[model samples]
Target: MKAILRTMGGWSQRAPTCCAVVMKHAVLWCAAMLFAALIPVVHAVAADTSLTPEASAAKMAAEHLMTAKIEWRGPSSSPKPLAGKRIAIVSCCEAADGAARASRAMVEAGKTLGWQVNVLDGRGDPQEQNKALNSAIDAKYDGIVLEFVDTTTVSDGVARALKAKIPLITLGTLRNTPDTIPDVSWDYAKHGEALANYMIWKSNGNVNALILLNTDLYVTRNGQWVGTKNVLTDPKKCKDCKVTVKEWPMANIDTQPGSIATAALQANPKINWGWCFDACMSRVSRALIASGLSSKMRGAGFDCNAESLQLIKDGQVEAVCAADPREWDAYAVIDNLNRLMQGQPTVNQGIPVRLFDKTNISTLSDYEMSHGWQGGYDFRAAYRKLWGMQK
Candidate 1:
């Protein structure tokens, strides 16, 4: 590597290049080369030692590119990285924990792709999230990614942003209106319906299914309420499988599901199947036990929380309808950001949903190690390949 020297108010010193030194002085030039070689080792050590994402990014850039800003604060900058861009992640579901991981990944990806990215957590509050959206639009970010908490009210923010000519993409849910907010998310209804079909197929139309349909009125705008309704209404697919649903509010899974299950079993003693929407898979299992019928029950749900995976291993639960929640959360937003940035049309990501049973649950012990959560996406990369990388 060559080094170019920029002298200021003193003796000449060589500027560093790819490992070559450019000092006029002969003795010092050899010394500089040794130092340059050592620089790589030093930075490598820093990368290993560093903990924070920002520090790691900076260290990586400094070592590899000789000049990189891992610290830019806005989208359009000297390096013009998406890392500097301001992104608001609006979530009503408990996708934050996973989405945060995605955000970290996005930061690294942005550093590589030359983006300055920041994520705003909206906590499922529509008005509060709306204010954040307005700020991003006013700041004139190169792109904006929005996750919806309320399907209807949030539409106003999308309309306003689009009216201001901002590209706004929704993640994890879709707004059917042509209000110009292109959303990239999984069609959640497909997941719900798939689970319903699988349960019916396994049971040969005889399983009494108790469904834990998560409340979306206070959570996300994913139409969980409507989606579950649609998925259950179809009979040709579900055949003779009897289905019942209870709207479980957030965090009450620990208490509410047991009562719901007890009553359902009391009213319908042959209830052999239970399905909770996401993380509360274990709670539903316990609910079955509370009903004094754990022996006859085989349960299923989404997400790979530690307790839930163990339930799968112990045979208390039949399978998990697992999705990479963090990948779903993070890229759901970033995919939208890219669409907005490029003035391209956007659609739902339709993130893949998989069924994890006992045969494969142990092999996925990484989820056990990782708070029972999965990170990799089967859909994002595939979609990227089909649609081309976002600008």
Candidate 2:
């Protein structure tokens, strides 16, 4: 002990005694052994916390001075620019609120990105839609988007699109499959339930809802209608119900208020509430007015467009189940198309759709008009942020 003390004193005298330096070196060596001893404990704790061994290994790897590390490359797919490519967009109808806004935003965005885009209006004809799709394939568009008329009709044409080696992006309500073609859309049933519940809650259970819907369009009506039907038929949900169609949506019926104004009036003398799975911009309000029922009816419809907002302003409509229609349409088709074009494997999340009330309507409308179909979601920023391209 005396000899060791004498040696320590000699070293301290020569080095001018840094106890911190000696302690740090000792602590590091001790910690190395302590951590090694705790590995089994760490493994147990990590497992109990539901972390896999691989993740635990990665965490340890991050603290190492020398590691065989691989940086995260990207999504199973890439989102490269679609510049200098022509894309074909198909719509169920040119006149409807959702289709029209999407078409406009897509055209404008494509122009900015230097891609040629052609929109083929199906005009509510499945046969015509198929024909236009055939033309798009023959014309050799780099990417083809199929907006289905019904849930199942588009599936029959999938083989044709696949055989051509062209990426067919199915938008709106579509199916889950093992095919290379990916789907893009929001949850339809949730949207329907949320809208219905909101309306029922707003009316205080005393009002009767006149449900005007299109049975043909799968995404718009068929899928949504199923949920709406469930709610309306529920004795616990809504009190009184009557379903009427001034003109079935997408019959290419001129937006004329004349044809169904009389029928709507006759269906019920005083409509406490009105609902349309449409723009419900002008004609429905007129039907209420023409039936001399405008003063009493509180109206709600799908989509938040300029005209819809105007109706809200004029107090002709209560509220529209306004999800950013432009964004819904754009993200539905564009995200997958971009993925396919760049030879990236696409991943679908249950597409997110948010309801817009009067509080947020003005902002959503402005955002859509200024930015195509993105619905305030900056795809470029979103991708970069998601990929950790930015901190």
Candidate 3:
């Protein structure tokens, strides 16, 4: 397991000096060399014998990471009822389909409950997010849903909202610290582990991987990276697996994943698998094909976006651990808000994360992708009943 040297809340406070940054890279390079040296020894031992019982069990466990099971279990107490309440949804950015779909879900869910819904777009700007929060507070909305906005950047705004006694629920804001606000998100670590395990299984324990990481979304991306490293480096899990990383700022991810991934593949010809924390990085498909590595490399990542699914269909990517922002997470946010409004203790709404590959891609209709992916379960009626909207 990788030991976490320090903990970072949503954002990094200070940039490292040039010397410190260089020293860090030098240390990482040394570690990578040591890891690479051991790969051949591990491969030789594995080739001599069939998988031990323990190793076989580990592989089976990895395969099972593909699907998630969720149960509501009902809230502790009845909800306070929100028939005429006003709710505001502040989105980090709608440019990304995930964020836009989630915002729409929250609005529709609120309206379904006969509540007034207001949506504010942050457009990926921290200042704009803060302004939206302030506007929501000034207007005295009964509750607020913050989607994918960095809480660290809007601490003052969150503080003000808390002072106003407006219950705050967040989706995709990565601060695990104890706060008055509640965050409704998936187990990001598990998502990463699933991706790593899928790659390991597909490669038959002989895998070399390059992970495209987004540092701006460090809270979640870092967890995924750590999970990937933990599985890839464990001798029991996959002794022959070797892994490396390339970091990109989230702002540049839209245009850089392809070039950066292409360059990494060029430098490391042995790499057979590519991984990303977000499906958006699947854009690297064109670059991988252009560089002549498309046939040799398989990719996996999180999110069930249209593009990622298309890549799976085209055979450029192998798998994706899917999440439906509109149907899964957005509903959780609304359910949590309802719990808060009614004086019920919030429950962890475990959103289902399913693995989508060629075998199952046919099950998805075009409508599902054009909107956000919806899970197998119909949760609207159950949630409405919990909120006292239905008998």
Candidate 4:
């Protein structure tokens, strides 16, 4: 054993050059393997630290929208309100909070301008809306604002109004058809984009969202749904994001939204965010709570309803794209009608939308909070000034 050990030690001392060569190769191989492993780690770290250019731009835009001060971006045409004109508002559905607010605002705005405004609820039915439109025409209204009702649904009534030369404007028409009727509407696609940007910014672009939409409603299909789906699926904006769309009928709004959301959540446990086209987040919040994922999941919506705003206050909802300044919208529509009555060219009142969340919601007054107004601007006074009202 001693002889063998001595022989091995002698061999190691004599083979120093050969051993150094083998050790150098071994060290080089180890370093190459380490660098190869670190390639992905470095890339992942960089991905975690930085956002894609699209995402960065979207985040900045979202932040600006969320915190931007509200101002009256206007018609810029100072026209005196046409007095003694009777305006009829054929509301799509007063049961819906937004539609109700629009109707009420029109009435209030009309009164402010010394005009008589009458509201007829369509109750969310096309036939009922047709009847309301016919009734308004029969009553000899000087002007009519189709508040939240699609003109396509009541083409005959619209034709009658056109024949009667009763200037017709729309408060929230989904499609600006006939090329004759002007609409005072929030840029719905922009609203959707703002909501999408907010979601992207908030989730850091890693989003799996379930979006609820109403195919029957044009605003959802042509506006919010289009904007959200485009942003979420766009590779430039989000790399690790996906969205599932669920269509719920407007007639079944009360019951279907919750079940559809829950079923979607159950079918795909990967869904970490939920977005609704309008104020449907109120029901979706209950579903999120029931699933025991409310704390983990995020919620976003449009047309910030009082219920959904309360959800934001309670930390259940993450964000809302709010645009329903009822009185302001009403005044804008009235301004359009006034222009028509006075034979002046009607101006497009591009109402701006704002994103609201925990960060800036506290700044809203109680009235503003309830009615979904972005705080810090007096649109009512601005509209009055544009209408050439002394008060």
Each model's TM-score?
A: 0.60, 0.67, 0.77, 0.81
Q: Candidate 1 lDDT, tens digit per residue, 20-69?
A: 33333555877899999999999977756643433333223223321222
Q: Candidate 3 has which clashing residue pairs, if any?
A: 80-342
The list of candidate 2 runs beyond 4 A from truth reads: 1-77, 154-157, 176-181, 239-249, 255-258, 290-292, 349-351, 357-391
Residue 279 local lDDT, model 3 = 39
The prediction achieving the highest lDDT against the true structure is 4
lDDT for residue 363 in candidate 4, whole number 0-100: 70
Q: Give the alpha carbon lDDT tens digit for every residue of 110-229 in model 3.
A: 887788888898866778888999999999999998888767778878889878888888887656333657888666676677776767666667779877776555355656667778
Backbone clash total for model 2 is 1
Residues 243-307 of candidate 4 have per-residue lDDT tens digits of 88788766676778888887887788788888874556778788778778677567887777677
Candidate 3: worst 10 consecutive residues by lDDT?
A: 1-10
Between the candidate structures 2 and 4, which one is better when assessed by lDDT?
Answer: 4
Q: What is the alpha-carbon lDDT for the whole of candidate 3?
A: 0.71
Q: How far out, in Å, is residue 67 in model 3? A: 5.8
Model 3 steric clash total: 1
Whole-model lDDT, model 2:
0.59
RMSD of 2: 16.0
Candidate 1 ranges beyond 4 A from true positions: 1-83, 93-116, 124-142, 148-150, 187-189, 217-239, 249-259, 286-296, 304-307, 322-329, 332-336, 346-351, 362-391
Give every collision pair in model 4.
none
Tell me how many clashing residue pairs each candidate has: 25, 1, 1, 0
Best by TM-score: 4
